[model samples]
Target chain A: MNTPTPAHVDGNAAAGVLREVFAVDLTAAVGQCDNCGCAVVLAEARLYTRAPGMVGRCPGCQAILFRVVRGPDRTWLDLRGLRCIEVSLPDS
Target chain B: MGIVSPGFSGRRRTADLPPGQYLTDDFPVLSAGPTPRVRPEEWSFTITTETGREHRWTWREFRALPTERPTVDLHCVTRWSKLGTHWEGVSLDTLLAGVETTADHALAHSYGGYTTNMPLADLRDGKAWIAFRFDGEALAPEHGGPARLLVPHLYLWKSAKWVRGITLLTHDRPGFWESAGYHDYGDPWREQRYWGD
Candidate 1:
């Protein structure tokens, strides 16, 4: 089996952790980068997991757009780095 | 439904385990970019501040600084914890002893364009190190060799790999992750993993 390089992953790589906090899959969410003003789906953001947490960067300008840090007691989701996070909820 | 790997069930609960972390005997390799390959002869560490002051040290010179071996636990945001990991390197305290700065934070720049930020206080007073050796040998490039910042107090991400320089800032500025969505001050023990939480 080929192991994916740590730095070359995408936002889809973060779906599992995101689900733990958001209840729904967040890979489909669209977000805008605050740093370079680029917009894209959350799943398209560049991801890095080599650290103690998961970090997602804007694919356009390489700005960190989101980060998810999960601890024993609680999970921390920081989306302020992104200008906007738009999630499409399923029609009830 | 999630698919489970056949051999992935070896992990179990442990008292020493931090909240939400699973005990893993394996040390996983995680990175935001390709592994950087650096030659000791061509490598150097620079310390710069917002004021434009800089301190440069070649590999030989950096190794001359006092070194220490500390065994600590590593907690990855991905829910894995490995304990009793041993590393050897110069203490940030010794490296910053003579340097004077009013900076409150640091931006650690790596060879591969990767950066991570932390309060300057977190890197001093025996809190962090520039580790060059792991498991009694030279650090491999895949694991951030030549030297990498080791910040045990925070999640391992605060420990920037392939670290080449430190830019001290008078004010806290988000590095690669902080600018993204990660918590500014990541203290795994306190579960300070995100922004508002």
Candidate 2:
């Protein structure tokens, strides 16, 4: 198919990889972009997987919000692009 | 390698697969952004040296260059290995023949704002090509046509889809995925999929 341009999916597509590191589903977590200070759900971020790992970019500034790389024995997660990630927990 | 156990029917022979990779018969289309529809008339390949020298070839000029059809096995850092893929393209050695460069590394820039870096040595001596055709057909846009850098020896990302030009660098510079913590030199055989790997 002749697609005019390459397209990216939402961060929801990264859940499988993220799950390897996080105990809970991270797509529902809200992360604030460190570059542009835009706060949004991780699922709302733009996800790119054309590379070695899954890259989540901030929808506001297109800055990489996080990167997750999975290897045979270990998974590397980098969230330096985000100022903070707020994950909601259930009331215990 | 270990001997096969009795009654063990594996999905496929692992002998051909690289470390941590699986064989895929279908070519998967993976892209960071929208596919750039670059018409052949508007396509050109350029090589820029650290000393500000530029060597360019328009699509027509590029097609006129001597081409070779290579059957190569591709290994992606994402763990997919496609074997015996056929391609037609001009070799990097042919393109860099007259270009002068003291650089040891190269950063490939693509039309869709994508970039990947590799040692200059990796692109020479019949190591790499700018492929325009695949499987005896015009390479599809989703698969990086009008042309794409082909470095089958390394992780497929190093091939740089939608590749337009290469900038010679005196020192190695990390590109898109490299900067994002992927290994700068992605070697699937070594399992260099992440930064520290």
Every candidate's lDDT: 0.83, 0.88
Model 2 residue B159 lDDT score? 94
Compute the lDDT of residue B172 as modeled in candidate 2: 96
Q: lDDT tens string, model 1, B113-158? A: 8888999999988889999999999999988998999998888888
DockQ of model 1, rounded to 2 decimals? 0.23
**For model 2, what is the error of residue B168's alpha carbon versus the real structure, in angstroms, after optimal superposition?**
0.7
Task: Provide chain B TM-scores across all predictions.
Answer: 0.91, 0.93
Off by over 4 Å in 2: A1-40, A58-65, A72-92, B1-13
Clashes (backbone N, CA, C under 3 Å), per candidate, total 10, 5
Q: What are the per-residue Cα lDDT tens digits for candidate 1 across A1-92?
A: 99877877778988876675487677898888998887779888888876656878888887677777665566667787698777776773
- For model 2, residues A2-75, the per-residue Cα lDDT tens digits are 76865888899999766654787889999889989989799999898775678788888787788877666667
Q: Calculate model 1's interface RMSD in Å.
A: 4.0
Worst window of 10 by summed lDDT in candidate 2 chain B: B5-14
